[model samples]
Target: MSDIQLPEDDEEQQLYERETENTPETPLIRRSQSHESIISTLSAPPAYELYPPATTWSGRLLNFFRRIPTRFTQSSIALPTLSDDRADERSISSRFRIPQLELHPRIARWRYPIVGLCVLCITIFSFLLFCSIFFSPASLPSPSVPDKIANDTAKFLTLNIFMRPPGVKNNWSDYKDDRTDFIIRHVLPNYDVVSFQESFGFGSRRKDHLIRAAREMGYNHHVESGRKYPWQIAVDGGLLVLSRFPIKDSRLIEYPRGRHSDWMARKGAIYAQIECKPNSLVHLYTTHAQASYQQITSLWDDDVRTRMNQFSWLHSLIAETSGKDGSAVVLNGDLNVDAAVHKEKSSPTEPSEESSEEYEFMKAVLSGEGKKINGKVEYEDSWKIDLKDAVYESYGFHPVTFGDVKVDEYGMVVPAETVLTDADELMAVQSIDHVLWSPRQSNMNIEGVRVEKFMVADTHLDNDEDEEKGYTQVSDHYGISYVLRL
Candidate 1:
């Protein structure tokens, strides 16, 4: 390149300076000052030449508004102030356009990651909401009935169905919906009277399904133990009594004492006077007593005392109601009192003093042996009657109604494949489930009562096959049934 030479005259020097300031290498301050000097050279004009008065009122009002300053014009980006002589033939947008804002470098770098995190959070929340709606009991469909129905004339059944509330650790019965389906289709149709314990749930949940199913299967009469508030004491005494026979009267009596979590349950007895025949009435009582919780042999513990108190209360209720009428009275439920001389949890060989006392006291109360009543009547345990017969000796020890399968610490029943000892079998068969009956003493219309059949019916879910892969029980306690001849 050739060396640059300085301009000699004043006009030539001024023109050279302007050209130098317009170059790309020159700073923006020099260029801005040059534009300001050019604008200052324009001559001042008359008000009519600057802005002519509008011909119409509306046009004049619009012209007035155009003169007012706006936020956009007041911003840091200075817009050119054009006079009439300098105004160009350009659109309003081109004349005054706002520049786009640029994000900071740090914020722009994390844009994609932030968007991805937000999407993931929304997806997880949607999935949780779907699961809560889909798995709820209210959303479940009714169970289908089998074509082969098993209906008997007169039979009695009692079981603890173990229907706990959902979302709890203790709601451990696997395939709970399937188990309930089996009961409605196969079991309820065969029995004349059915009583269930531990049917716990809220609103139209598991228990409501059974109620609707039973009513459809001709079990029209039903009674549930009343509910209690949290402040009053506990929830409902989870008892549901169903009968094909017409029920004349019904009452529930909750025990005053309890132990552990049993204190939070409405554990009690339910009494129902049902018409077995057109003119023949039967007094039915169902109850669920205090749980042992692996401490069955402790006679001096709070569990034992609470149980004793419940028994006494039950005895008084029976004496006051059916004892005076001399009607056919039948008591069936989970009493939590084993008939065995010794319990499995205690010394295997040594006799349990608690068991002996419980058995004797239970028998005395049922038979009205010591308590003075208006009409003294005797009641017999149906299992004892059936086992005492010489012909029925091959029937073996009493059928194991509960604990054949163990429940883990979280209240889930162990699998059927879990091997149990001989002592376990011996103890389980002598469980607390029982049925006691007393024929009417003064009524000639009623006949003598005899247990034609006694069985611990399997309440397991069947798949309609002879040999199955594994056994799945409906509840911890088996359903005990009695086919009676009256």
Candidate 2:
């Protein structure tokens, strides 16, 4: 305890310090401190452990194998770990581990349904297109033979004849000779039976000319009954039927006189019976009744009324005499009375007092009012019937009048405009020329009949003319022809 003097010598002091240092700790506190220092150094956490695991090598390896199906499954499967920190992080990582979808599965499930839907739509459209092509109304087939036959049978016979001798001037002598020549060269040569109106002859030799002409033309069976004027200036006059067939009977029927103080005389119609075939008879009538002009309307009315009476009478006669015998009746000629008057409802241009009378007469005739003769006789206006069906069919026969003729071409008789003014006038003028027959007689084969506007060439007349100036012909009316096959 005496002053624990320290050695001063350096080497001898170091040896002495080692010896003292190597001795067991003298204090309990110092021994504990030494133990604590050793333990702290040995138990200290590594810097690498503070951070996340070094997954570079494992991650690379896992990604490499993930492309394969089996490896991908194994890699996606969560593995259980022992580290508390790693376990906590695993929970979070698992939340984000989204499952990869298989490309083949998606395509396989969706492809067929989409394709089927498209195929169904295409099939439906194709079926509709096929049906439209084959079964549409516009694609219907042609008419059958039976339909054609029926249509043909319903048709009418129409004929147009021109009887003007060529190279004849507009003189009376020339006119007479030309007419005679026409009867011989054109009428007799071409037709077995003939009906003519406006058979005007020139000079003082009227009767002689007509008789001679008729005889020469082989028309031994003839009827000539019409208004005869003193100076041969007869108006609203006509001729009758002259045929090669056997003549059975004949008569003249007169028309009514209207309120015309200035008219010269009443008009008339001629009816006759001709043996057209073996043991068969046909009624034939001809007339030149009235003109449609306002100045002559009263006269026309008178003439039309009378003609209607005659028509009715003739029908009765045929029904009584021939209809029972199965004989057909044909009323042919220029009645001057139109079968249908389309303008009955309209007012006339430059109308006069007599215009109304004429309209009434026309309306009466067309409406079948004045057609009665003896209270029981009935005659169907064949022209009207044929016209009604004209829109659907070409019945072949139209009357010879101003309405049926065209200026650009030479018609059988005259330009249609000269006669027809409107629809009413067209109906009236169209059937003015006709050859009506009993449906039961003449073999009644409508299909075999042909109606045509006799061409001007056939009548030995020039048809071509200047379009602006109209036709250059002789007559004011056209000639209608009917060809009936018995």
Candidate 3:
């Protein structure tokens, strides 16, 4: 740096010039240290500095943030130099309000818990609504079809409908709509007479629902097996018949013996005599024999025995009731008797007329092989007969395998897994739901029943919805509709 020469009034300037020019200067007299300090004593006070001594980058940032307000900080230790009322008079623009200022420690602590509670409340409410509507329980309704199917001897439908009693099972999860609405919308509109097994009416309002719905749908003629008043009937023998034509007569017969859960309801048969035409009367036997041989079965041996016993009663009832007349008779129901599908090792893919032990009992009544058991009335299965005929043989039937890949139930194809069993092929491909007819007594060789169209209605292909475990398919069993010409 260059030296600064003070204007020291010639004497100090000449000395500085002489020193810089390399010339010797005269020596000044030395004064005493205390006396010179005292003589030169007083100096001016120092001036204020514009900026503080913060040199490094971090130091500069610390100084800058120290000037900000403390209300914006949860802990102001980072800016300890900042005062409480820093910029108290500054006006914050309304558009730039600070949300962090309003955050409370307590509210922050419970924030997630409160949100979780709200979500839980919504989920519970949704579940309740689902139960009350889709799954809650069960119904019936009006018909749009004519009172009688014209010119046909028998136009009928039979289904199990899986009408389990209210609150007894988890039906709330299995169905997407009320069973009555489903029947009115899907099942009843297509057939003349719809017969349902397991239509229990003991303590619940379902029986009333069906009657009311049926009447509304123009199916004014309907009957129940029996009513115990409040609790008289066992588990509601659950047999019901709804007909478009007038039901001239109706009767109920509860079996004497039922085992296990069968004891819950008096399992039985119900039949009705309908006037199909002026001179031609049709005896419609709508019956549901006992079946304790379900996948969810208990007391297997006892259930089997009980089911057979029930069938015997059913046999006797049909024999006594069915007359050897020219009038037509259709015994249709969830008979729970499949002649070909009993053996665990049987391939379901093969549709053969294979008989199980229980099938013999049913065969005796239907085929008139009961030479010892009165040998009076003989009946015929509509499907087996239809297969032999030319015109109506093309129609299809499907077994409701719950979730298994399906096959035509009318012995059309064999199958793999079904809803009830893990076996690769089902025992047989036919439905427990059966449709049988009594041949014209005039000619023993002529069953006299021609199936124009025999269909397993509301089979898996009928619905657009997936068979979700908790909510799809109104019943485990599909409905059956048969157009018969006798």
Task: Give the winner by lDDT.
Answer: 1
Q: What range of 10 consecutive residues in model 2 has the weakest lDDT sum?
A: 145-154
Candidate 1 runs further than 4 Å off: 1-153, 168-173, 228-233, 343-355, 366-398, 405-429, 442-471
TM-score of each: 0.55, 0.44, 0.53
lDDT (CA) per prediction: 0.58, 0.44, 0.54
lDDT of 1 by residue, 204-253 (tens): 25677887888777677778777543335565667889887778888889
Please give the TM-score that candidate 3 achieves against the real structure.
0.53
Ranked by TM-score, the better of candidates 1 and 3 is 1
Query: On residues 1-486, what C-alpha lDDT tens digit does candidate 3 reach at each position?
Result: 248655556566566566666533333322332223323432212122234758899878565544333334423111112222432332222222344554477875675577668879999888666544532234454456457634644567777766666666532343323555566656676667778887776556666766676777678788786654422435667888988887887777888747666766777888788876655566777777766435523223665556556655665555566554555566777777644443567544434344455555555544444313345433322222110211112223324322223456675544332332324324335445666665444221213222211122334334653333332344555555666553
Sort by lDDT, top down from the best = 1, 3, 2
- RMSD (Å) of each candidate, 1 decimal: 16.2, 35.6, 19.2
| Per-residue accuracy of model 2 over 1-486 as CA lDDT, tens digit each | 557765566556566566777655422223233434534543445433444554799765444433344332332333233343333232423543548544476664675566568879999888767645432222123222111112112212222222222232333223344334444544455655667664432123343355555555455666755434334333333354666566788877655542242144345666677665555555565655444443234333554555555555544444444444555555555544544334565332211122134333433443334434456434454333110212112343232344543435542333344311333444233445544444453464323333444333445543452223222232434554454445
- Cα misplacement distance, residue 143 of candidate 2 (Å): 52
- Between prediction 1 and prediction 2, the one with superior lDDT is 1
